[model samples]
Target: MSTVFVVGSLNIDQNIRVRSLPRAGETVRGSDATFSPGGKGGNQAVAAARAGATVKFTGAVGDDAHGRRILEVLSEASIDAGHVRVSGTAATGTAVIAVDDHGENQIIVSPGANSGITAADVDAGLAAVQAGDVLVLQLEIPTALVRQAARTAKGRGAFVILNAAPAPRQIDGLLDDVDLLVVNEQEIQVLAGLAGMPGNHRDLVQALPPALGPAIVCTAGAEGSFTVLDGSLVHVPAATVAARDTTGAGDTFVGYLAASLAGSHRDLPAAMIHATRASAIAVTRTGAMESIPWAHEIPASAPKPATPDPATPNTASPNTALSSPVVPN
Candidate 1:
């Protein structure tokens, strides 16, 4: 199995359950609050570990109690956290999350130490990257550092998966280093304005200019997800389940997907199916890292060998590609 490398943010997530999301200028009542280790990077690292992958993590946190807790969680998951940094000047990152009874959530994040990652840190974290390895990145950290890591990994023959969370306004040159682009419906909508040349979401993806590189996956919540293969759109359905809190579902899916892809036991399509099951299980639970399911909990899809996703296109343009790891593509 290939080693999976993850570089992103780490945070202490404060979760509160409410009846419904409060609109702007509104206040609502909720259930008791809970705090746990989260951050897309940490959550996905745990998810990959739970899904049977050997993982290495690179992230930043403060030299505080929350940071210690993050380390403890990583230790428990058996992830290689040697590259994790304890920032000297910043407090640990934090996220205030509100999950409605329907399982939808809104989050406000204070970058804090998550914004403390340095170029040297990224280099050290990926020092051992080798061909056939899997490199996963999220937008929680500095984009330049991520771009450097992606380019470095690509040069070393590593397969790169970029989860563009908190989706950036423009991805032009960044996509050049990534093999796969992942995004959610809302994030995809951000790019819709650029492509100004579209119909529905599917058409939007299919019509994406080749300059944006190949392989874009879009997760559309309950509606499932879709990806472009051979320039044609392929859809994958979601597993049926009653969601409790959807907090870490996307992280779970990304982690499992990266692991499955690195495992070489199946192609991206089959791995997407496997990953979807894992995320479905996560939504039925609560919290972020606490919500990710173990490998045994998900039924792995049968092997369906096929070509890898990053083979067709080359450049990444705002006028082109995307996909979030949650649903299908």
Candidate 2:
């Protein structure tokens, strides 16, 4: 098994369920509220660990109770936290999430200590990475730091997988350095600038630049996933399940995808099938990290993989559709 290193943010998620989201200047009563450990980095780290990956986490947290609790949560998930740092000047990062009746979510984040993750932090943590290891990253932390980590990881002969979530505008240069880029429908549109792209497997694959990386995976919630590998495109449909909350589905998908890729199964299509199955299980529950399924808890048989569309055309354009709206938590 290959080790997975995640360099990102750690946040305490404060979640509230309500009948519907309130309009500006309008007030609505929420049904209930709960707090859980969450952050793109932390969530993916936990998800990867639960899916049987040897995972290490590197990020910053505040010297507060939330920070301590976050560490405890990561420890419980068996994620190595030797690279985590605590800062006295800042409070722990927090995300205020509002979920409506339709399993939709809205989120507002306070960066706090997560923004403090520096270049030096990534450099010091590079000692744990080795050849064949997988280094996963997101846009939650500073872009400069992510770039530095990618460069370092690549130099060490490790595969770099970047989940460009919370999409950043300055990600074009970083794509060339990444080994894999996992994104969603909105992200693809933003990167390709193509509108009404049919959300098809081939269309999504043809959208990305081939020289940027060896593979590109585009996740479409409920509709399933699309992947482009070795100049070929494959579409994997999502498993059907009663969704209670869609808060961490994407994170679950990416995390499990990373784990599967690191494991004995190097087949990208098969790994994505497992990832989609894991994410389907995630949407049936509530909360972010709490919803990610453990390896033992996954279904005995995964979903049947979908064949790529042979007749699909290559419609690559610069005028892209609006990015997919994130599910409110």
TM-score of each: 0.89, 0.90
How many clashing residue pairs are found in candidate 2?
Answer: 9
- Per-residue CA lDDT of model 1 for 80-154, tens digit only, reads 999999998999999999999899999999999988899999999999999888899998888898899999998
Off by over 4 Å in 1: 300-329
Report lDDT (CA) for all predictions.
0.82, 0.81
Name the top TM-score candidate: 2
lDDT of 2 by residue, 1-329 (tens): 88889999899999999889888899999976789989999999999999999999999999999999999989999999999989999999999999888887888999999988877889988787778788899988888888899989888878788898887675556765687778887777666543333444446566554434435788988778876543445678889888888898899988998888778766667778888889988988999999999999888887766565566543433211111111000
